[model samples]
Target chain A: MSKTPIRLTVNGLPHEVAVEPRRTLADALRDDCGLTGTHLGCEHGVCGACTVLLDGEAVRACLHFAIQADGHAIRTVEGLAAPDGSLNPLQRAFWENHGLQCGFCTPGFLMLATWMLEQPGPVDEARLRHVLSSNLCRCTGYQNILTAVRTAAQELGKWREGATPA
Target chain B: MKCPPFDYHAPRSQAEALALLARHGEEGKILAGGQSLVPTMAFRLARPASLIDINRIAELDTCRAEANRLRIGALARHARFERPVVPGPTGALLARAAEHIAHAPIRTRGTFCGSLAHADPASEWCCIALALGAEMRVLREGGERLVPAADWFQAVFTTALGPDELLAEASLPILGPDWRCGFAEFNRRAGDFALAMAVTALRLDVAGHVAEARIALGGVAGTPVLAREAAASLLGAPPTPDRLRAAAALAAEGFEPTEDAQVPADYRRDLVRAMTRRALEGSLAA
Candidate 1:
């Protein structure tokens, strides 16, 4: 019934917004922060369409209140690309591998994959499948998504090994 | 779906949180992880007039493993257990169970104690807690109390927590060196709630006979059911194939299961039997 002032850093940008206690992080990001790349599919916790990074961990923004995210760092799909607008390796891999169809679930997948790629060490097909199981993609049947993630993991690993750092 | 408007208070300390809870009483709900509560609020199933956000209370986020138990603070996220801070078989079991909770994001936000407080009959935490005989520490304005996991869960979506009380932490008993643990569940898909699940910890004596067994099943009852009869049957006896099958059968007995649109009661009972068998076999092999 009351508004709460919140300060959050979104995609390296500091934001201060006054919102009702019930306003979800996803709603704040889309409506208030003007970042619409984060999709809301189920609204409930089931669908990972509202997935975003909170302090570097992938979390369901819809499941978090905007006030709860105060003083936290958030990274949405919009932050995945370079500042100059070049697609990241994961995005490029998805594009080349036909990882997305309909694209409603791509943002969630991208954020989730980004979190996975951020982890240290090599990711095998089994680990990738297990991590990707969290996000659902009605279209593409997931083979292309798996291929895309695998390709991106390889590319990212090579980049990390100092092979033409992106 | 959007959450209905509610007054929010971010308490900085446990005392402040308790005072807020006492003042607001039933009208106030403690928000931790907000994975289950937020979705329920969005669906209008639960509408507390005020929310007491305890995430800022640093004292409530502690996770320490002691000599005999692993003390997990209420705010400790499920993701933490995926790579447990504690060592040994208990931590390994918790990590394995954490992997089966929901999705990665849900795991990142959901808390172990929050899941226990939510008391979903099919929750992995509920089953694990019951199997491990975890003790839930409750705090209030007056004092603090510890409730055993056996008496904590009352029914589906219900627990022993009072309106003015908050679950502060859960202390799960560590598995002894002689004990081995196994967990198995039957879900339609990965990340979905289990239709039926079994968590088992067994210890074998020097003579290759079952020295101790703790078995718990979920989704087949209103609360996580401890298979006392099944566990008792294996005591002092070799867990042979026939003996294990009989015990698993006993675990599915004396319970009335609720039938939902997705799964029938009979199917759930079958799953309970199968899962119990698998869990016992896995523990034995471990």
Candidate 2:
């Protein structure tokens, strides 16, 4: 089987790689692109471990082919930090709240939370809990993760308000 | 569990996709959203020699409201219907059902037509499509045909779609002003495959009598089961609690549910009855 040449922009970086047509986006990100922040728990779509943002919407990286993401912008956990290497609000909140126990599922949670926080208005706790339920974290039992996301949303909200010109 | 090696063709047009499907015939599989196909491939359950990626086909990514129906292109993601993309009762029903699908991320990439094509018995789209009498527009090499939802799904993971035919779009019948719809399902987790599900659409006449009713059940049969007898029982009668319960009980009649490791057949039948009652009551309340 011949490999297909495809180009994708990941974490604001563009790269062209030759991969088999069957190669999943998760494997391509970890192996070809060398961004292993996107973990793969249940290679199937059930586990949300490989969640990433494709064109700003969260999707399971393991469920998509690399070639299918040729012209799309993908954001992984590695991209969550600012260019100055400072932790983003969500990451900082997670750290302060002790959101992770083993840290294996943190990347997926971060990406998912990034997408949720990017939404229009302030997300209520109930809605946030519902959205956060999509991704699983076996160790944390999710209480602190929920608190972290809530705190991050408030922090982001304040930051956005401050950045706005009065 | 990596997918087996295969040739990938990303066609820019539906015509090109159809040509690729025709050329490869049974060896080709249309890749749209890839929610189900990719997972199955990763598990080595399905190995097509060629994957015709239809994501690039611009014409197949649309959701338009026709005068009498909502035309959803094959590549229209499930998330598009999570809200009232199309106004009115049909759109409301679609939004209700779409939110019940796996999750936000899965809904982002999973196509509504892809679910209908995959024909999963536990699929929310399958049950809603059957209840709404949606028509699948299939395109082949030389011609096209419309398969009504009633005749579309054949069995588990099977459809009336021929090997060379590509489902281009689905036209779901719009609900009239008098129509009210509701969808309910029981799953262990929020996004798990439904153990038993019910979708209902009801229209009451000016006299408060049942004018028309469409009830469909999932996870109780090989395909989404349209409760024809149960719906018939509701016709011309007042949608009272008694009538709804009797009709809900009748919905489980003549259906043989297979017992799985987690749930027994009897329990599933009871769920069908209970869900049917809830769906009917909710639809009326809506």
Native-vs-model 2 lDDT?
A: 0.89
lDDT tens readout by residue for model 1, B1-286? 8988899999999999999999999999999999999999999999999999999999999899777889999889998899856666788788878889888888888899999999999899999999989999999998999999989999889999999999999999877667878888999888888899999888888888899889999877789989999999999988898998999998888478768887888888889899999988887775
B-chain TM-score of model 1: 0.97
lDDT of 2 by residue, A60-129 (tens): 9999999899988999999989889899889999999999889988999999989988877677766686
Clashing residue pairs found in predicted model 2: none
Tens-digit lDDT track of model 2 for B157-217: 9999999999999999877778879788999888889999999988889998888889999
Q: How close is chain B to the truth by TM-score, in each candidate? A: 0.97, 0.98
Q: DockQ (Cα-based) per candidate? A: 0.77, 0.74
Q: How do the predictions measure up, each by TM-score?
A: 0.96, 0.96
TM-score of model 2 (CA atoms): 0.96
State the displacement of the C-alpha of residue A56, model 2, in Å, after optimal TM-score superposition. 0.6
Question: Model 2: runs farther than 4 Å from truth?
Answer: A158-166
Model 1 chain A lowest lDDT segment of ten: A157-166
- Scoring model 2 with DockQ, what do you get? 0.74
